[model samples]
Target chain A: MTAVLRRPTAAAPRARGRRRMLPFSPRHIALIPIAFVFAVPLLQMFLAALSPSAELIQYPPPFIPSHLTLSGFQRLFAQSDILRWLGNTVIVSVVAIVSNLVLCSLAGYGFARLRFHGKNFGFFGILATIMIPTQVLMIPTFVMFASVGLTDTLGAAIVPWLASSFGVFLMRQFFLSLPAELEEAGLIDGCNRLQVFWRIVLPLAKPALATLAIFTLLGAWNDLVWPIIAINNPGAFTLQLGMANFQGVRRTDWALLMAGNVVATLPLVLFFVAAQKQFVATMTFSGLKG
Target chain B: MVTHTAVLRGSPSRARARRLGSAKRTVEGWGFVAPATILILGLSIFPAAWAFLLSLEKWNGFSTPTFLGGGNYAEIVGDQQFWDAFGHTALYVVLFVPASVLAGLVLALLLNGRIRFVGVYRTAIFVPFVVSPATTGILTNYLFDQQFGIVNHVLGVVGLPQQGWLTDRHQAMLVIAIMSLWGSAAFTTVIYLAALQDIPAELLEAAAIDGANRWQAFWKVVWPELAAVTVFVTIWQTVQATQLFDLVYTTTRGGPLNATETIVYYLWDTAFHQFQFGYGSAVAYVLFGGTLIVTLIFVLVSRRRSSEVI
Candidate 1:
């Protein structure tokens, strides 16, 4: 059933959408309160993190402290291996980022461009794994890694993440949107398939690659459960595990715990802010397609 | 779509080139995808089969397995704590999903119209989504602490009644729900915000010219356009809520009286805490089955609805 009714003519690039002549409208007045609801938790966390211990226990804690101090951060660095955990976090994040970029783009390119037997079923098999609950995989996967003696190492924490279902899906979607003619031209010019992909295709995939990198960075940095399941050694703790352990030992010490949370969370906050458009585009792409 | 185009172009070429060219293309294609297949399939599918096999046996983390057939599944069907966790999760999902969806959509609508500082507002909202769930758990635990927590402090200042948060069973659920909302809204809001932006302006203008006011125009014009997205958000949130482990694990650990224990958390507790690998695998399969059923319903319903509209 060959059905090609209409080639999708490129619509005008969706830029410069409906903008009112003046920025200030009755809408902005309405928006402030709603946005405030979303902003309050992060703000309160920051304020609490900044408050001195005396100020924190003073009956009713003030949102704006009379004076702010870095005693908590100082004590955090002085007492614990917070710096080591942050390093481990960076390693996992960077490895996961690079691996997802290369592996997912390669697989996504195969799904999008190449012709092979079992291609449809193979791709669908990958997609189906997205619906399989992560908990089901937990026991077997942990055992699988432990069998290979990689359980408490960084390898255990990052192996499953080297390629993600969502990363592959996103890359494939981006690749599909690209015109096949670009790759065909490379093939006609006596280039092999891999060369065509590396030279002619990958340069144009900067946006998709950026999206994959940001997604992996966020996922790897913020990951908690897998590290908990896989790595138990105190020295091997990822950032989240380190922060969790810090909270446990310093139970009532809200100042230090909140400070730890802020320290751990700040990089991701900075990352998202730097790549806001890419983040939003990824969100949009996933939602709209689903 | 790309695959369809490939098939269309591939057919005529196959007539002249026959199997050898196709065979060579297949090998090249496999070469590209094999690395991912080896990794993903090894990590995903192989484990799933292993899990299913483990579910049918009775084994702890150690010792040789004793085959128990359907005994674990039978036990799960009659388990009280399992059902208790199930009820707790249902309640959590009930409170969390609709509220986040509605809150996300409303904020998206408010922020939709050409506005200033949208990026600033978005960063403020989306910041929560990027923070580690465990970090969020720590932050919220402090915020909702009954006696010295700032949430209680603010409530007292506002002359509102101070109830025990993170203390009472029902109140603990509310606290977790609030925390879930704080973490979840950013992603949902971004989705809704983008969908709102994509709604063509001409459709809204057409409704206005037909004498529809803003609210009526939104209902008649914009609402239908967003139905698919709303469904997507709903299902995404549902699956995410069902896998709600890290937040509860960090905050309460199934808490004061098992009031907040969810399917995933309980699965973790059973598998890891009790070292009952077989039993844990059974519970995992149950969760997987339930998720698959729910997701299938959503997909089928949405598919039929879209096809009818076309």
Candidate 2:
């Protein structure tokens, strides 16, 4: 066994030595063109946002803007209900984030650690629900919401996103991976299940909760289809629905559209930058650990 | 309710106590899931059910739906336009989904190491996922625009003719496909990267010691572990492909003689534009039905595969 282990150990050194054969291996460089292609769209959006009128629409669009301008953004803020849309989006997303953190955690913890009857069965049922396409549910949901007179409210946007099957599943998986000893100790120390969950597991779950929040917020913020279907009133339009109005049937106002894009995209970028490290850490932990 | 609980609890009085406890737990459980469940069921499931009922009717959005029964279904089956849209979607899946899966997998495999700037590469690949698809669609529109787009401009320098990218029926779907790949490949890559990282290093070393080449090791060991990720990506891509509204809506508006018109786009037009709620509901149901069948098939296949593995 020792001899066999020694051969593999020795092989590692040879592999390291062989690494010197290429200055920059071709494989590593293969990602460059693809990454560049991915980055170009974002760059152009930035360029379009900066370029002056007639410049953006000009044939053979300018590769780079001669001078940057914030006119589009200013126009966006000045004309449209951009601020209202932003406020609406923030409200919906914040509600979704908070609710998901609490509700998903409770359900996830229940499924993960608590000894409940039909636990496995319930989980599998939830898992099975994942396969049902959301498309089928949309029309019925609209009718139901309309009956309750909740059709035009932000509540329609906020509520559906809060209880994702995936969020519960993610949290459950994370909870299962955690050592039960800590929670068990808390229990022995006169902590009930709810108390143990509140003080012990909740703090430990910041990363997963954040990841859930990020995804939930992004989903809620960028949602176009539901808002379009649910809200005909301009007062209720989220940023996406509000911005889409720029593409009029006859002619699109590219400047306003570009402005709207910038306004809509900025918050997401800020959120990503602020929580990027935590986001990445959680992604790897939740996705890979499974 | 008390008697029902008593029966379940086995001793009448004990059962009563258990019933109360269980009822409270059930209520709590429902409360936990209430907001989301209610909304989803209302907005999603309820709409779907009403749509299905509407599929059997003939109504404008404003009018009372007249019963059409199976006529709409028959009409959909005979509708050449629906088939054309379906064909476009199939073509899209063929061109875009596989190419994306391969690109994502390759990126994950290439970057699944402690290389210098690996984090940078990973982030660069994933940045697109966070960017709005509508923005990406617009950017791609300009890039691949025939006359003055950067793509044709590049091709022009290469002495190649500028293709009518968004305007040409044949090329329109390709441009949208490319945009779709650009927007979604990042998420797929990240998921694949996660899957790749889960692969044990010892397995690779063991395979290498057994004289398996890098290619052999990847196929035998790495690919199996990635099977789940592959399924996830494929299902996601398929669903996203069928729901190909955003990019198509933004870039082509299902235009250039409806070359890029997907089922969802068609449905949107029927319901929102034409006010043919009943007909649109039929289309929606058909799409839902197709998706359901596909999902069922995938689930069955995966389950069987798992069983076989076990």
Best prediction by TM-score: 1
Looking at model 1, give its docking quality level. Answer: acceptable
Task: Put down candidate 2 lDDT per residue, A1-290, tens digits, no spaces.
Answer: 11112222211223543546677656567777766766777677677777775776676667787788877777767777889988898888888888888878887888777554455666666665565565555555566567678788886777678677777887888899999999888877877677888899989988688878886777777777777677877787777777665555313345556667777787786666666665555444434422
Clashes of each: 0, 13
Worst 10 residues of 1 chain A by lDDT: A1-10
Best by DockQ: 1
Scanning candidate 2 chain B in windows of ten residues, the lowest lDDT window is: B36-45
The candidate maximizing lDDT is: 1
List residue ranges in candidate 2 displaced over 4 A: A1-14, A113-125, A151-153, A179-193, A249-256, A277-290, B1-47, B295-310
Model 2, position B62: C-alpha lDDT score? 59
lDDT of 1 by residue, A239-273 (tens): 89988877888877777777888889888788777
